[model samples]
Target: MCGIVGAVAQRNIVPVLIEGLRRLEYRGYDSCGVAVLAGGEPHRARSVARVADLDEQVRETHLEGVTGIAHTRWATHGAPVTNNAHPIFSRNALALVHNGIIENYESLRETLRGKGYEFVSQTDTEVIAHLIHSLYRGDLFAAVREAVQQLHGAYAIAVEHKDQPNTVVGARQGSPLVVGLGEGENFLASDALALAGSTERFIFLEEGDVCELTLERVRVADRDGNDVQREVRTVAAYGGAVELGPYRHFMQKEIFEQPRAISDTIPQADSFDASLFGDAAAKAFGEIDNLLILACGTSYYSGLTAKYWLESIAKIPTQVEIASEYRYRDSVPNPKSLVVVISQSGETADTLAALKHAQSLGHKHTLSVCNVGTSAMVRLTELSFLTHAGREIGVASTKAFTTQLVALFVLAATLGKLRGHVDASLEADYVRQLRHLPAALNSVLALEPQIIAWSEDFSRKENALFLGRGLHYPIALEGALKLKEISYIHAEAYPAGELKHGPLALVTEAMPVVTVAPNDALLEKLKSNMQEVRARGGELYVFADSDTRIVSEEGLHVIRMPEHYGLLSPILHVVPLQLLAYHTACSRGTDVDKPRNLAKSVTVE
Candidate 1:
């Protein structure tokens, strides 16, 4: 997970590169650096600091140039420190920024060392810079093309040389790279969102394609040194960086933004139809006999929840797989099965790879519930449902998760209609609930005060367990993940009945047990599970519906859900868990927005 932005222009492009890095800050970085060919000398500065801090360093040092490259690195090969920061320079006036792993770096480094190349920093990326510099042959693009042939594993690299003052060369293998076309200027970045401010037109370089950028033009070439053509496309209108207007942190702001996000994502009650999944969805649903969902992180949890909706409502058998693990394992694929991928930013590396892997296996019927229309997953999938959750800046997803649930609910309901499982009144009831969802979300947001009061308990704990049954089981897992992600607390989730098997042994007075107590058929069983926790001297934090009359007493605490949402309860139930994690992280003084060791969009696997 890293961000790369480069520019070639008539004027100083340092500001543009810095702004692009700021926009990319949400991708999660441990350090940031910028390199510019100032006065025909590659001048650079790096810091194990935030982009904001990097900006101040650039300003204080006066680093600027007409052509430049910048990087925000999430470490994989070395410790995250100032010395290991990006824009790794070589003695031959070359500066390079890389996004993915160089798997054969150790052997390459040893070979380079034997060739009289001295290394300064311990990073897989540094080897690339040194190798490129050693192989320099007066042409930057040609030299990089030759250098990459000697490398192994994934990379999206942008290289600039002091001698080549007006150009930047970029190459991609497994990671993503794109070219931004502008008037009298050209650019390269890892994502379209990074270049949205300067250019609307983009050329997405295919895997193994190397491209050169200058002030007035961009040229594309294949790995074998032949000229190629890449089609330039316009990006859809999208919101830029969100301002922290009134909230203390982006996580908090996103938690409160849920009401508006949910309202915008769900279709209007009057517009409810089989066409909600786009024109091709109906055909795909009709043709498919089973479902396979691929996703990672929070999206994987959303897929888990969708499995329940698909099996119980649509009568379709569904299997959810973590996208990163799906392609590596041997599995059966059905040509008639719909392969669904869920991602907030459609550029998630593993999910996209899994989509391609499934396609290679002859599973061509594909769909995606993604937020960005311009993302690669949308382009690769047969059909897409774009959620209007807008720009989710926080690394720990809030609005995007709920919005994906809304999209999946629509997909499930549409399949139900096609399968003749829903009557007119039942369909109308679902539509009515969609119309009332905004109001319901607003009421759920009201429970924040009560959640914060309970968060005082969570803040003091070292470990926690989440329990849910049936559909809410995924919600419990998501809650545990959120807590661990943001608060650095040890947390786990299990089905309520699974306690007696193995997890109940870990419950103690020091451990807090969080239970999802929705008033459904499983409520009584969940209560018995809560009793088991209580018997182990474990404190209880129960999220329950209004009618579930379980009150607060000894060793138990209850946070009431304003209303029971029936089939759509998971979406509402997750809000309090989000609040619980946010407040607990705040109480622990952890970074809520950009959590440690985690990036927002994982562009590299």
Candidate 2:
């Protein structure tokens, strides 16, 4: 949830460090800081404000140095205050910036305190600084290597020593860290997006790998202290997606960009092909008899939707698991199952861990649906489909979720064809629907003004309920998640039939009920569910198709969708929910782009 940038250069690197932190602001942070080895001493400036304010503080203080590290921290283990910010120093000898939590910090802090180390901040990261200082033996890299052996949790740290100017040492355990290759200088960052403005060549460090950066060279070492080599790859930069051009917030821009994102994710060919996922996808898909989809957050909801498609269309049994819990519980392993991991950033810690766990259980067929091609998930999987939702800056995902659905739908269609469930006519029909998805998304996005009107009522809501059936049930879950994530509302979702079980008791005049009323087989049952809500005096807001004759009355409100896209309606229904959440959060005056305590890429479990 935090961001880090380190630089070792001949020129003053303060501007570079600040720019990197600015690029990383999308990750969601509460504090920003910069530490520099200036004039044989460590100096730092930290603020519990925006990066712009931190930049102003640095500029006003005239902070300059040849080597430096900067951080934007999303609070964990302590409150978001200046005293708990990063760049925590140790006895004026070393400075460190960390990304993940340290599990054994309490015991380490006690040991350090016993060694006469005084703590100034309420942060686990401060203990790391003291530990490194206590282990210093004239080599910054050696001290960091020794100190990390005692640590017991995920961390990506960059450290600097006053005695060794123009040098930076970076270590990675479970969190992500990268080395940016420059002409005369080298750098370290948590993601390539942070260094996209400076250089494209990067070395993604492996787990337990450490690297030392200087003006002219970069040296890598493994966990056992032996010299190692990491592959260097070039990453393309995001051109205009990084800028907010005429939109009020990144979330709004992402909502409107869903049409383009979906179009780019799917091909307009006459038939779907498994090779689009990877070269070996066809063989792997042929060998798998069962499907296991794993993900977290919004991606997990997308997987839940895919389970319906794989089972009904592809004639394959499928199961979806939340990535955070998949590795913890004991479950039966099937060697013939295809393990699919979905993530927007590809670096989600629990999803990646789950993928590795499945592999450890002898699941050879693995695939990843992700947005970033250079992410750990894509690298670790046997096959991958990269969604072209470029640079999603919003903490709540919009375009990324839609594009992932497109990819999973394609996967479902390809498997159906291979399994003899989809004939030529069915394949052509699937292709036609996919090719028309962009236009369908455009028409759905056109209903924003009406959705905004509904949001006016929802903005006054303290609690809400969403109802959907079959494929749309997952969409309802996603809508509830989006509303609760951005608008600070307590929202819950249940299948339309499940309303009678227990959720119907929560219905009242004060509770707003949002229903996905597509004109499918479940429309009649959904209509009955709406009547149940109406009988309970619950106000109903329904996103219905043009032909689903659900008209608006006193307590019932209906917004007709442009069309009813069979099997593909979930993608269309989700756009309106996104708009509702976005406008509601706007009316509530909450930060739509950077929601509280949520990060764009969840790198820590």
Question: Best lDDT goes to which candidate?
Answer: 2
Per-residue error (Å), model 2, residue 145? 1.4
Candidate 1 root-mean-square deviation in Å: 1.6
Q: Write the per-residue lDDT of candidate 1 for residues 525-570, one digit (tens) a residue.
A: 8899999999999999899899998999989998888999988999
Which stretch of 10 consecutive residues in model 2 shows the poorest summed lDDT? Answer: 235-244
lDDT of 2 by residue, 364-384 (tens): 999999998988889999999
Poorly placed runs, candidate 2 (over 4 Å): none
Worst 10 residues of 1 by lDDT: 268-277
Candidate 2, 59: how far from true, in Å? 0.8
Clashing pairs in 2: none
Residue 334, model 1, lDDT: 90
